[model samples]
Target chain A: MTTQPVTLRRRRLHEIVSPLTIPLVTLLLFVLILLLAPASLPKLVTGIILPGLTLAALYFLIAAGLSLIFGLMDVLNFAHGSLFMVGAYIAWSCNVGLDPLYPNHWPVTIANSNARFVIGLLVGTLLGAGLGAVVEVLLIRPLYKRPIYQVLLTLGLVFVFDALVRSVPAWGSDSKAPIKPSLLAGSLEILGRRFPTYSLFLIVLGLTLAVAVALLLRRSRIGMTIRAGVQDSTMVEALGINVRRVFTGVFALGAGLAALGGAAAASFIGVYPEMGLEYQLFAFIVVVIGGLGSYSGAAIGALLIGLARTFSDHLVLELGLPTAIASASTVLVMAVVLLLKPGGVFGAKE
Target chain B: MPINGRRTFQIAQSGIGYVPEHRAIFRDLTVLENLTLAERKRGDLRRSGDLIFGLFPRLHERLQQQGGTLSGGEQQMLAIARALVPDNRLLLIDEPSEGLAPVIIEQMMAAIQQLSAYTTVLLVEQNFRMASAISQRYYIVDDGRTVHTGAMAALRDNKPLVQTYLGAA
Candidate 1:
């Protein structure tokens, strides 16, 4: 009996790399790089940390929804990024159309931004949710027991959604023109540097959402069901809960969150046809690094990626690295992280 | 096709409750939320309350705990509690004794007996002794199909039936 406790302790220790190891190594590497290359250090830290955080925040918002869907229903939503792009387009259109209605709308009031943001968020979420439901009911539902088929079907959906988005006109000149809100157009001073206020807002909004989601999942009944469903969906279904309804709800929620991220990003960055693909890659990286199905892990992963990107960009520029090499810094960091911890920071070992 | 004046397609549409065989507690939700979500306002609140808490006192004690953190026995109790919230006349409990200690199994049997007082129970249990102790009628299922049905006591008294049908003597 005493040996049992000892064995359990040893197993627990062996199951994971002590949580302190990654942070310590990351910190040590960061310090050594700073000491060895002082001139390039500032550039790397600033460049990678700032924009990376911004981008990471955006990715977090998008991936959080994907995480929920994957965790709960075991569905891979390839069209997730497309839904986000659609949200951005919707926000742009709403801003262009609704701006004239408000007085002094040129400056973009909290009220005006609120109205447009809400409209974009709601419409995008609803559309994304509706599309998700349709995808599940039409495609994924039939292949419930077959995991491979579900993946393939969703992959096909990504192409279908891409084509649909491309069919629309590009932002300004044609029907497809990606619109930007007039309010989010200005920049604010950050550490004596002018930074886009909208981008900052986007980052804050992402963090707020991440916190809300964490609370919801931890506290709410629906959230509990979602957690339980992730572990064993069949058990939840047998509890007389409409497991089908829960699946639909989860899909819609994830899609809507992705759309919110898309809409927020669209206000700062103009909408383009391939915008979703670009975001999809970033979101996938964040989800993987943060640990799929762990919201807190996603947030932490986003922050780390953001900071790393900022630092890498600066370092590359200072070192006079080739433009292509400089651009690849984010990818390099992600690769290292993956090599170090395959399950990601928060994921359980398989 | 109609069933008892309703559509025959809705044959299984009567007041029904289901207990999933696997452990699927909404990992993110509290015990109370799990119970409340399944509850219907149309039913008698007093009766629902009495039926639910009466069977599982642990649920009442840990109403605020997240479903995922509960022990196996507690999760089972919560699962059963959630099912009873809807006030279903016919309750379906799947493998309640699975993975439970003997003491917990005894407590589980007591809860089932208490629930059977108000609602008709269709318990799907592999444990013959537990089923026979708690149920008046029994059905033996093999490969997703029902193979035998009879009085619980008859199945218990008959040595051949116990051994052949349930792998028990």
Candidate 2:
């Protein structure tokens, strides 16, 4: 990048352009929405923001994990989606298994539904993380240098996981809504707009997790070390760190975060065999747009995608355009971004 | 053969403070984060930071700068500082003078002497002037095996042998 002769003007322009791009694009979208439908803008925004935030938050879960693993380990784990699917399935099982205490298909009135929700998340996450560590140690670690071998092995696991889910009589390729705590089931009046309580909960959870992770990387000792390991693990090893152990721990953490997202999204997406690949693809898109190693970039990328999808769908419908076009809206947004900045919104060189 | 090859990596893991010929710096991390990584792996980071900064003050000034962006001398300083992180009984430095200016090399030699006062130094150096200036003893290797072992004084005395083996050090 530096080899190109840089005039002072270009450097100043770059300084101006770098920070303004994302915000300007975001504002342009809002302006377009306002111009297209001023009367329903408030209600439309409220409604759109719910699904938009939900989608963005869930995507962050998967994308963040993907970024961490890909950045640190240099291992392309094609089977990461399996971890997400396992999480949702575990949440479903936990819900059904606790039926005697809360009753199936009924919101709990006696025993706390919130407690049940926490239990489901905890169990699902634990199991998902365990599966991830086992997979990393056995299948993925050995194939780091051989991309072809990694793809073949992990691609095989992806099918194995999907088939395993299909084998379960209750799950069986079909989607089923996992239990939701009664507390999070309805809309809540916030400011002037009534917002879905679950969407708000997810937004809060997602923002908190993202901020917490960013803080950990910027502030914590272990986080600093892991970031360093991403660049030069040999330097870390020479410094007396057991880098193998750190990699395993991080791989498990990344998987655990994905599982948490799945468990949390179970009530939203429902547990199913194909659900992993769906979110996994969305995660890929988010990472590509956000820049692979950038956490904040991923968050912004997710929001852009979620909001774009919702707005594009609504706008297309209002204009009486083909609804089929709505499906490609997110991908279109990604393409546009790529066309402008080929390295992604935040990607550096590679 | 350079001990900087793969076999040296095995020796590198055994509590040795290995400053590789390539420096092995974490290019993406900031200077502060680079030192923090080393100290976090061993003992107290703040204590080590205070100690390392005393020797390589340039690192303290560029704490927020990325490792890749630093000058060659600064990167070398970071490498040596990282090695000093653990309670290392011996230091294994490979070509500290490589790619540095003469003034920077002199500064590095001074830092090496300071480090040696605290612990044993097993310096893998090619620069004979710097090596003879500080080394008490020397070993010359050919084809991955030791060919000569003697005092630095003896190596200096044997000019023709030194010239034949190391090309007029």
Candidate 3:
């Protein structure tokens, strides 16, 4: 009888502790940071917050699509990063007529104007979306029944796409920064902190897209189909929805989003041939930390990792630690989250 | 007719409700959304609500709950409820009593029997008792081929055939 009471108490304790793991760890991390570097508070608000949100926004842009595509199709698209790289290269070409493959070839004075820049962004996003659609139809469609083949095909595409970009005479292996539009080139003062205007634009764009996607999933018929498809796709087909077509649409949507994220990232950090791998690595981490197939998990995971990385960077600087700690912080957080909640905060329990 | 080839949705659009085996309800969606998604014709949606609620009153209480969170019995109700929401001319129910407590199975069998009054029910079941209780005609297939065909009452009289094909029930 006494043992039963103890068992009940232990179960109660677990019920309470399990839900608080992430928040409690987050609080403890903040307390430790404050104690270790008390002098960095102003910098935290002034420097870290906007940039942290901007980074989070960029992470969300890539991770959201990754989460959806994985959730619905069960395909791990390794080419996502390469798609982002291709998008940046294409957008760059549109801005300045460097690549013969794009609209403004060299000696075409139609390049470098603000109108051209706007046109570049539009063309870049649309073409990225279009390329994603084509890839789905031509390559992904045939391999739906063979999951291993899908993985191999996407992994192969990563190398092929990277090599294809490098082969373009205009793109090459060098890094090129796209000039920011005049509207986004300036900086804004927030709470006496001057922040780049472009970063704020990214923050707004990411937030807007997140809401839009969430609303689409929650409210639309297509969204219903996706949610159902994720659970049991064959049943969805039996229900009379064109599930094959939905698969293609979702793959294209995910690729397009990743490409747009690449175009946006081009302005923040100059576009290099290898940039896609860097962002893709982080995008994978964000997806894992968020829960593999959960959209809200992706958004929350992005915010957590974004802030954690930014704060760690500041800590490294303030404490004179090696710069590698900043890079390692996100992985550490992921490890902790996985240890506590193996399925992720929002992922379905295994 | 050849049923218009492989596109299942087109066949569904022609007003056929399918309750596949294993209660294939979307685990992620709410009970209401499950019903809402099956609504092919908006004009007849009001009738759907009345029919489903009338058949399985327990679902009305769990409208907001996710399908996966429900008990197996409840999930089966949601599956049957989902197929019935649209204005379907025929309902093809597959093994509603596959995995259920005797009590739940009785309730499900009763619900299916009640629904047969509203639409054509083509039930495929291995349970001889359930198959005989709810159906008029009977077709017993062995190894992907029909071994016998007769009325349910006639099949009940054939003790040897029941023992050979269906086993003692």
Candidate 4:
């Protein structure tokens, strides 16, 4: 009887604390900034917060795909980084392809950067999905039961993809500037502070994608099969749905999202061969921090990383600390999160 | 044709449903999702759903509830309903009355009998009363080999055989 009361109290405590953690962190930060560095509050909101959210959106875009595939198939796709990198490059290529025809062949981008960006995003997503399908069939299918082999094989595939990208001489340098679509070129004044239009777009896209994917998984027939298959795939096959085909589709969707993220990131940071691997590492950290195989967890993890990175950078500049320590903040946050909850913030119990 | 259990699992591409003892319903998905996913084709969903609903009307009320959230009895019904959704010539239901209330067991037994009328049911139940109720033939196995094989009535009469293989049927 005593133990039961203690357990109930703990459950009630958890119920109150867990959901509050997300927004409360940011609110507390805002309050702290307002008190100590009153002048920096607006800057933090515009410069740090908005951009951080945009970056987190990009990370979520990539990690969502990663989380879904790993959650369902128990396959850790190390080549996902390569997919992200290629997606950025593909988006860049699409921009170049559309540049010459500006106002001549395809008059859509003549005065409207919206059409151009949309087309570029579509091309990148489609290419990424196609590549994902090819990889799943050729590389992943044979290695499903042998999970250890999957890690080694996919890690090797990452190297192969990196080499292939680097071999393409026309691909140019990693530092090449991304397209500056006319419509997405300017900034918006929010409360008398300027905010990047592209960042706003990224945030919208990320949220929309989250809602859309959630609905698709929860409501649609195929999406239901995929969710169920993630729990028990062989049983799904017995139910008359081809689990392999579902795997292929999910793999493609994840790759497409990663590619889309890359393309979105390309608008700001541009594309590079190694960028894929770097983002791949971030995706892993975020997914881990959030939870394995959990979409919402991945998103939460992304937001935390994004906010932590911004906060660390601001702290470094403000306090005149070494700049190198900025990168470590993400790791520090992750270490702390893992320490508190090994399964991640929203992960299932082991 | 010689039937090896391993080969049967491997070769049978279609027309066979195996509900393993684990109650292999998609725990993460909803009851409707589990049932709808089992359809061979998108056509005739209404007809099949109505039929399943007729058997287990409780499932119709809990359509949106997740499979894993359901009680053991509900899950069993979902498993059976899911198997019946697709056009299957034979259903291999393993241990239907393992851990359930006697009232629920009675309901499941009745459902199994009704299911057998439409599709051939190959039930693998341990409870002697459950096995004998509907089964025409019974196979008693011990030490991984068949010890007795005959009609259910004959097996009932053979008390020594029942005692040896099934520990008193």
Chain A TM per prediction: 0.82, 0.88, 0.89, 0.88
C-alpha lDDT of all candidate models, in order: 0.69, 0.76, 0.79, 0.78
Ten contiguous residues minimizing lDDT sum, candidate 4 chain A:
A1-10
The candidates' DockQ values read 0.23, 0.39, 0.48, 0.38
lDDT of 1 at A322: 72
What's the C-alpha lDDT at position A125 in model 4? 90
What is the C-alpha lDDT profile of model 2 across A1-350, one tens digit per residue?
01110001112356457735764676597568658855364567576766788889988988877877776776667777789889988887777666656344445323666666778889888998899899889888778668789789988999999999999776787788767878898888765788778888888888889888877776787777667766666566667676777788878987988898899989766788888898888888887777665566677788888777777777777787898777787787778777666656666643
Rank all candidate structures by their TM-score, best first, as comma-separated numbers.
3, 4, 2, 1
Per-residue alpha-carbon lDDT of model 1 for B22-132, expressed as tens digits?
A: 645554456776676665553533457776787777788888776667899999998787777765788778899999999999999899898888889998888877888
Two-chain complex of model 3, DockQ on C-alpha atoms against the true structure: 0.48
RMSD of each: 6.5, 4.8, 6.0, 5.2
The TM-score values for the models, in the order shown, are 0.79, 0.88, 0.89, 0.89
Write one digit per residue (lDDT tens) for candidate 3, span B61-111. Answer: 999887767999999999898888887888888888888899999999999
Q: Which candidate gets the maximum DockQ versus the true structure? A: 3
Which run of 10 residues does model 3 chain A get worst, by summed lDDT?
A1-10
**Highest lDDT scorer:** 3
- TM-score of chain A, predicted model 4, versus the true chain A, to 2 decimals: 0.88
